[model samples]
Target: MKIMNPSLDISWTHCGDGDDARYGKSVKRKVDRVESDGRKVLLDTNDSAFDFIPTAEPSPGTIEDK
Candidate 1:
């Protein structure tokens, strides 16, 4: 699997209903990648049932000086 951001935090939630309702819970994951068509791939699993939102905070080094 191609990791676009190893440390990136992703808040994923299943958007499916009915029989797939069991998977309709929000969870957080670290490993993620973005497809060329603007789809978020989580853990290398490509499923359209979930929507991913990036929740990673900026690194300390990127936010403040040492």
Candidate 2:
């Protein structure tokens, strides 16, 4: 089903490079969020083995560091 209110949210974030720590697996992700059917949710890839985080990508006039 296509999302009615596909809140278009985007951001620049650090992501994992696909490798294990012990087995040299080290990775990270820049999380993002979306709104659909009156509910907020995260945007993620289907290949990840974990859910790191889910949050709003900063909006204009919002607080952020330089």
Candidate 3:
């Protein structure tokens, strides 16, 4: 199904990537929100696994940092 309102809603947050991913296996994620059929949900590949992060290409904003 095609998405209607595709946005990322960050539920919680931490300082930044100043730490490692396995640091207590706890890290903050920049949450993404996706809506469908009047239902809202959080979507973040990082939450799935650090492995997913590799598959993600940097977004425009991230490119600016480089």
Candidate 4:
């Protein structure tokens, strides 16, 4: 991965061994990652919404906790 602009670009690469590349179904499989040279991937989760609930009004003889 690399920082080229306001965002980052990522890539993937994989190869097989022992004549596995002949059939194209290589024994090696690469997964999508933020780093290619075996480095830690920094990522954060984003919440799409705010969760808030309004409290009910106190009744004539109801007690509320502060």
On TM-score, the leading prediction is 1
lDDT of 3 at 43: 43
Q: Assess the local accuracy of residue 17 in candidate 1 as a C-alpha lDDT between 0 and 100.
A: 42
- How does candidate 3 score on lDDT? 0.34
lDDT of 1 by residue, 1-66 (tens): 354453342323433344554353433443366678966555534332233323333343222111
lDDT of 4 at 44: 22
> CA lDDT, every prediction?
0.38, 0.36, 0.34, 0.30
Which stretch of 10 consecutive residues in model 4 shows the poorest summed lDDT?
Answer: 44-53
Estimate, for each residue in 1-66, the C-alpha lDDT of model 4 and write its tens digit.
Answer: 553442232332333334643343322212224456765343322211111112223244322222
Q: Which stretches of candidate 4 lie over 4 Å from their true place?
A: 1-34, 48-66
Clashes of each: 0, 8, 3, 0
The predicted structure with the larger lDDT, 1 or 3, is 1
RMSD list, candidates in order: 14.4, 13.0, 13.8, 24.2
Q: Give lDDT tens digits, candidate 2, residues 2-49.
A: 433323322332333344423422233324453455443543654333
TM-score of each: 0.23, 0.18, 0.19, 0.17
Error of 2 at 4 (Å): 32
